[model samples]
Target: MVDVNSLAALLPDGVVVTDPDILGGYRQDRAQDPEAGTPAALVRPANTEQVATVVRWAHERGVAIVPRGAGTGLSGGATAQDGALLLSTERMRDISVDPVTRTAVAQPGLLNAEVKAAVAEHGLWYPPDPSSFEICSIGGNAATNAGGLCCVKYGVTTDYVLGMEVVLADGTVVRLGGPRLKDSAGLSLTKLFVGSEGTLGIITELTLRLLPAQPPQSTVVASFATLEAACDAILAITGRLRPSMLEFMDSVAINAVEDQLRMGLDREAAALLVARSDAPGEHAGLEVAEIAALCEKAGATEVFATDDPAEGEAFTVARRVAIPALERKGPLLLEDVGVPLPKLGELVTGIAGIARRREVLVSVIAHAGDGNTHPLIVYNPADADESARAQQAFGEIMDLAIALGGTITGEHGVGRLKKAWLPNQVGPDVMALTRLIKSALDPQGILNPGAVL
Candidate 1:
């Protein structure tokens, strides 16, 4: 076992925690991987310098380090390894917004919602919003290149990341890019680290570009008698105009959400679509009306349009809460698979077939505008047979995505859980190039060992 006495002595008191109970809490992230291992110690650094100090110590001792933010990652990217030091950025909350430049420099520990609120104070907005914005850390968003309801319009975390401060594997701190909107100097190292999932380096701070406050949005909620009709509506809406948000929930997800929210959702509908338009001025209403018409033309069972923000948000909440609502049934093997918009219907149907073959209950919800679907496979862990079937269905879903020229992961990084399918998706050549880059940056392989590459 690597002794952490010298490491603890270098940092401020209480920054290094070694209690077994506390270490257990950091074993696994939201992925809840059954094989996650306990960490040696948990380190909560308050600033970049402290982080560097910890990394420097680990680098010299050849100790493995796992960087984590908020422990809300769904890909097991932050899952701790036995005898590895778990570095949590929860204590690094700090942010400064520059209204003049329309940017914000934020520490990795700040929650995504907090960044939005902070920037909103200056009449600016940070657009990348994962569904777990309320609980997920801004650093994690950047690390995973996370996307959400608005991503189909504004783009993902990498879009707004103008620059960042990262600690390389050797403990060298490098600042790439900046508040400048346009910088052509040097390689795009900043973009390289945005979704590297802590394998290359640990992000300390992010220079995020901001946008002006969003205009009031008009929302459209439609229920379909069949999943195919809902997919048609999604394709129609996207083909017509860009929406601020376009979400889909299958009947399993709809019923699950309705069970929790009691919002009078159509329990029998095969699928539900919630779309929004934030077009300036009265155009928002016009766009929503058009979307409603398209839904009706696509044979929606029922269509509802509302200009009320509260009513619209309620439906969006229903779509967002589908995972938790389904979790109430049993443990879930969550899959984030995405295909081209043209192939989304096939992907969704293919997933349904996998669930049927495995004899497991699968609830699917998605940012349909972007063709990214989250299929939640529910299983009774206590039942060995059921759990085995669920695992089989999980792999089958990824295999299906790859066969359809889709990705195994859309927003979530390919952590330990999804690394097996990565090679098949990217092919051996791209995989070799990835390894070359990983070795060049982290020759010792101490950073996020066993992830991605």
Candidate 2:
């Protein structure tokens, strides 16, 4: 075992804490892994040097180190291990925005929304907005390659990641990629680490690309009598122009939101779709009208169009709040499975079939335009049988996604909860390559062991 006292000595005072209560707090992330282990200590590193010191010490001692940011991970990505150290970047919260370069060099601890609001002050935008953006860290976003509602149009975290200062497993500090967007040199090492989920390295600072603030958006909210109609509207919307955002929620999700927000959502409707167009000037209104028409042509029960920004924002907020709102029903086993556009309807219907067959409640909310669905499986943990069925439904949903040529996880990292399905999705050859890289970079597997690979 490593000496916790010696580890504390390497960092500044108060950087390391071994308090039982504090350590208890670091035990589990949002996934609430029941088997989460008690960490021996928590190391709060404010800078790369301190992170390097911790990693070097851990590597030398063969101690497992779990890299955590904000501790807001939805998966078991940041769960502490027995006698392991939780190396948190919560104290590393510094951001420098360069409007001229259209980039922000941000410390890993900064929240996604904070980054978005920070860049917006300079009339720029950092596009990735996870539902937990208000709470989740930028580092966590990079670790998971998080996708959001707008990702259907703007792309995910990897797209805006221009560069990063990463602390490798053995404590070697290496800079990958940079401000210049057109760097084609060397193997795409930076891209590899973008979604490595802290198993391979600890990302300290990120150099992120930014775009101009989104233009005023027009909103379209459509209610469908059947799932097929809503899915067809989704396909039609995508077949034409690219909207800034397109979100979907099934009847259960609609009713859940309505129950919580009293937003006058249609309870009888089988599905609801919210589409937005951020085109400049009158174009946004025109595009929204087109989208509304598409929804109507696809047999929408009702189509509501609005040019009022506040009205549009209210609907967007309701969409973003779907996960939290749905939580009121029961605990959620959120699945982020994505399929090709054409296969999305099949995937959604297949999830419904699984829920019925397994006799579990699965409320689906999705970034429909991108074909990424967050199938929130609700179950009463108190009932052992129901919980087991819920767990079965969870795996079955991912299996269905894989069989349809889709992904098990579109944004959220494999973490510990989904690691079992990873090899099944990526195949042995890719898994071997992943292991090779993990071995080459983290020889002892000390950096977030038991995650990703």
Candidate 3:
């Protein structure tokens, strides 16, 4: 057993905590893996130096360290291991926005929404907006390479990350890249670590690129009588031109949101789409008009357009709240599977088939324009048979995605839960190369053990 007293003495008082009650809370992240083990100690570091101290002590002692952000990860990437030190970056909330350079230097603990708000004060915007932006930390977003509703036009987390500060396994603090938009000086080490899922190193500070504030977006809400029609509209819209936001919710998700917000969503519609266009002034209106025509041509049951920001945001909020709304039904086994745009319809239909064959309820919502789908499998854990079925469906969905030449995860990292399917997606050679890199960077495997590899 490691000596807690010696470790505690090296840091400020209360930085190293071993209380059982406190340790319990850090054992699992939002993945909530039942098998997650109790961490030996929980370390709350305020800055990069403090984080390095914890890493150095753990490296010398061969103690495993699990780096965690806001604990909002859907994958089990932040799940704690037995006898490991859970290093939470929650207290390191600090950010400096540089309006001149259109960038923001932020500590890892700041929430995603806070980062957006900070940059907004300078008449700038951060493009990556995960649905949990309000609760998920910027560190976690980068760790997972998160995406959002607007990612169809803007791109994901990696696109906006100009640089970052990382603490490696051996306690070495390295700075990679910087605020410069273009840097070809070295290997793209910065991009490599962006979605490494804490297996490569712990991110301390990130220099994020910012854009001028977004223009007022015109919104289009379309309802379809069948899932197939909604998917047709998605492809048609994306094929024509890029939209600021394009989102999809099936009947399960639509009714779920309606149940919670009483927003008067078409509860009887088989599918709903919330699309947006942020082109300059009149162009925004023209884009939505074109989108509405495409939806109507694609067999939409009803289509509504609005230039009012408040009205548009209300629908965006409805799509964003689908997860929590469905959670009210039962515990969920979430699967993030994405396929090529052409295969979107096939994947959606295949998932429905899986739910029926497995005798489980699965609700799917997606950043439809980008072809990434989140299928929520609702099952009662109290039932042994139902729980087993849900687990089977989870693996099957990933298998289906692979069959269609798609990835196991789009934005969410392969954390522990989805690591099993990673090799299937990436062939043996890539897996071998991944292992080699992991071994070279973390020979002792002290950093985020059992993740990715």
Candidate 4:
């Protein structure tokens, strides 16, 4: 067994926690992998130096370290391992927003929402909004290169990340990039660690690029009698104008969300599309009007357009709550597969076919504008057969995505859960390059062992 007493002696009194009950909470992230292991101890560091100290200690002792943020990751990126040091960055919450440069140098532990709010106070916005932004950490966002609704128009986390302060595997802290908007300096190494999922190094601080607050948005909610019609509308809308947000939900996801929100969603529709336009001034309304027209041409059963922010936000909330709403039925095997825009319809239909063939209830929700989808496969873990089928369908979905010229995961990182399929997606050459980079940075393989690799 690992010596917890020695680790305790190096940090503050309460920094190293070995209490079984407390460690239990840190075992798994939102993915809730059944294979999650019991951690030897949990370390909470308040500053970069404290983090480096913990890493140095662990490196010397040859103890594997798992760097974690708020643990809201949906890909099991932060799952704990047996006899490993669980390094929690929760206590490293600190931020300094530079209004002049429109950049914020924030510690990894700050929640994504907290970063947005802090920047908003200075009339700026940080727009890489994962669905769990309110609960996920900025460090975790950077770690996973998370994407969200606004990403259809804005961009992913890597786009907003100007620079960061990361700790190498051997406890060496190095600063990469900065508040500068344009810097072609030195191999773009800052971005290399952004989505490394802790296999490269531990991110202690992030310098995030920000923008001025968003403009008023116009919303469009359309319901289709068939999934094909919805896809047609998606193609039509994207082929024409750039929408601020374009999201889709199939019959299963629509009913599931409606069951929870009771917001008078169209239950009879086979699919729902909630889109928005954040163009300046009256142009927002014009954009929504054109989108509504496209929905009609695509055989929409009903169409609703709104310029009121409150009304639009309500629809957005319903889309965001889809995963939780579906979880009410049973445990979920979530799949984040994405394809090229033109191939999206084929991907969605293929997933439905997989669900039917596997005899499982798979709900499809997506950032349709970008062709990234989340297929939620519901199953009862107590039922061995059903669980096995769910697992099979999960792999099949990734396979289908790969065949469709897409990725196994879009915004979510290739954590422990998705690592198996990653080799199939990126092929042998890319995988070898990845290993070379990982080895050069973490030769001991002590940082987040068994993850991404």
Candidate 5:
């Protein structure tokens, strides 16, 4: 084992921490993986140079290094391991927005909401708006290639990422891509690391592309008596026009959100759809009116439209709080599964069937326009049999998604929780290629061991 005392001596004071209380907090991320192991020490690096120094020490000693960002990942990507060094980038928050170039250079530790606010001051927008944007770090966003509500129309993290500075396993720092809009460089290395989930390298800085401020949005809220009707409305809306945001929540999620927010949501509705349009001028209202019409045509139980931004925002906030709201019921086994747009209905219905068969409560909320769903499986941890059943249903849902020509994970990376089903979706050939790339980039295997590979 490496001497942590000597490691601490090498860095600045207070940079290395061995307090059991603090180390205990770093052992597991929000995923709460039961298998999370105790880390030897936690290191908070303030700059890329310090990060490289720590990586070099770990590389030399062949000690595993787990890179973490704000610890908000739904996947267990940042779970600590035995005898590993927990490298937290929470101290490296710095950002510079260049309105002239429409880009921002940000350190990894900046929160997504902080990045958005910084860029917005310059009349620019950072489009990727993950539900956890207020809490998640920008580095984690790039690490997972996270998508969100606006992604239905704008794009995900990789789309906004023009360049990044990454530290490889051997402590070599390299810069890939740049602020330019287009680049046909040697390889698409920037994108390769964007969603690597810290297995390939540790992201230190990102050069993000930004767009002009979004237009005022017109929102539409619709309720359906059945899930199929809501899905039909989603397909119709996406097919007719691209809405700025298209979200879905089932009866369980609606009730959960209502219980917390008391926003007067229709608890009797089987499913709810919240669609928004940010088109220029009167077109925004026109688009939402058209979407409301489609919902009504699809047999919606109730249809509501609002051009009032605050009222629309209240509904949007309700949709965003679904996960935490559902967690109040019991422990959750979250699944991020996605399918082709046409297969979305089958995916949701199949998950409901799995829930019934497994005897677990599954609440599904989705970025419906893009076909990515967050299936929150609620179960009582005190009951081992019930927990086991939830686990079984979780795997089965991923299997169903794979069978439906879909992916096991759409936005959230295949962290430890979903690692088992990755090969099933991508097949052996792609798995081999993935392993080959990982080995080539991290020959010492000291960077985020036992993650994707």
Candidate 6:
């Protein structure tokens, strides 16, 4: 066994922590894996060299290592392993914006919101805005390839990521991609590591591409009496034009949000749709009006549009807060399942069927434009049968998405929680290829063992 004192000697005084109390807090991430293992040590590295050193020590000792970002992952990607050293990037935050290149070089620990704010000083935007953007680290976003509200229009972290610096399992650093927008010079290694979920390597630094500030947006919020009506409107609005934001909430989710926000949301409505357009100038209003008309034609009981940023923001907040709103009822099993546009209605309906069959309270909130849905399955831990049903529903949702020719995970990477079903979704051949690559890159299996593969 590696001596605790020797590990402490490799890092700064406060950097290496072994207190059982402190280690307890680092054991599990947001997924709250009940089986999370206690790490032998926790190393909070403030830079790439520090991370590499920790990795080298663990690699040489054949000690497992779990790479963690902000511990905000819904999947168990950051969950600690028994007797392993947890390599946390939460202390590595440092950012330098190059306004000329329209990019920012950021350490992994910087919050996604901070990255946006830093680049926005030069009138730029980093568009991956996860609902947890305020709390999630840039490294976590890249690790999960996380998507959010603006992703419908701007794209996810992988799109904005021009380059990155990752520390491999052997503690050797590899720099992939760069400031150049178009780099076909290599095998797209940067893209490979973006969503590896800490299994392939630990991301230490990121080179993010930025865009000019987004235009002012016009927002529309509507409620329909039937799921069919809401889905029809989604088809109509999407078929006609692309909206910067297109989201949906089912009746269960609507009631949950209303119970919390009490914002006079239509409780009788079977579904709610929030749409926005970032078209510049007068075109923004024009798009909002068209969206309102689309909703009306699709049997909207109520249609509301706003040019007021605050009014628009209020609705966006409600949409982003939907998950937490539903979480108030019980512990949640969150499923990030997505399908092709045309198959979306089927996916939602199939999930509803599964919920009914399993007898679980499953509330769905979706980034409708991309057909990605977050089905919140509420359950009580004290009741074994109820918990079993919820787990069944969770797996059923992923199965349904797979049947619809969609991903088991749209944005959130498949961490340990979903790894069992990953092979079923991706097939054995792909799984073999994944294992082969992971073996080649991290032969010691020290980087985030039990995650992904």
> RMSD in angstroms, all models?
0.7, 1.0, 0.6, 0.7, 0.7, 1.0
Across 195-310, the per-residue lDDT of candidate 4 in tens digits comes to: 99999889999999999999989899999999999999999999998999999999998999989999999999999999999999878878999999999999999999999999
lDDT of 3 at 312: 97
The list of candidate 2 runs beyond 4 A from truth reads none
Looking at candidate 5, the ten consecutive residues that score lowest on lDDT are 1-10
Off by over 4 Å in 1: none
On lDDT, the candidate that comes out on top is: 3
Q: Least lDDT summed over 10 consecutive residues: which range in candidate 6? A: 1-10
Q: In candidate 1, list every pair of residues with a backbone clash.
A: none
lDDT of 1 by residue, 1-453 (tens): 879989999999999999999998888999998878777899999999999999999999889999999988888999999899999999999999999999999999999999999999999999998888999999999999999889889999999999999999999999999999999998999999999999999999999999999988889999999999999999999999899999999999999898899999999999999999999988998899999999999999999999999999999898888888998998888888999999999999989999889999998999999999999999999999999999899999999999999999999899989999999999999999999999999989999997787
Clashes of each: 0, 0, 0, 0, 0, 0
Q: If scored against the real structure, what TM-score would every candidate get?
A: 0.99, 0.98, 0.99, 0.99, 0.99, 0.98
Model 3: per-residue Cα lDDT over 206-255, one tens digit each: 99999999999889999999999999999999999899999999999999
The clash number for model 5 is 0
lDDT of 1 at 55: 91
Candidate 1 C-alpha error for residue 289, in Å:
0.8
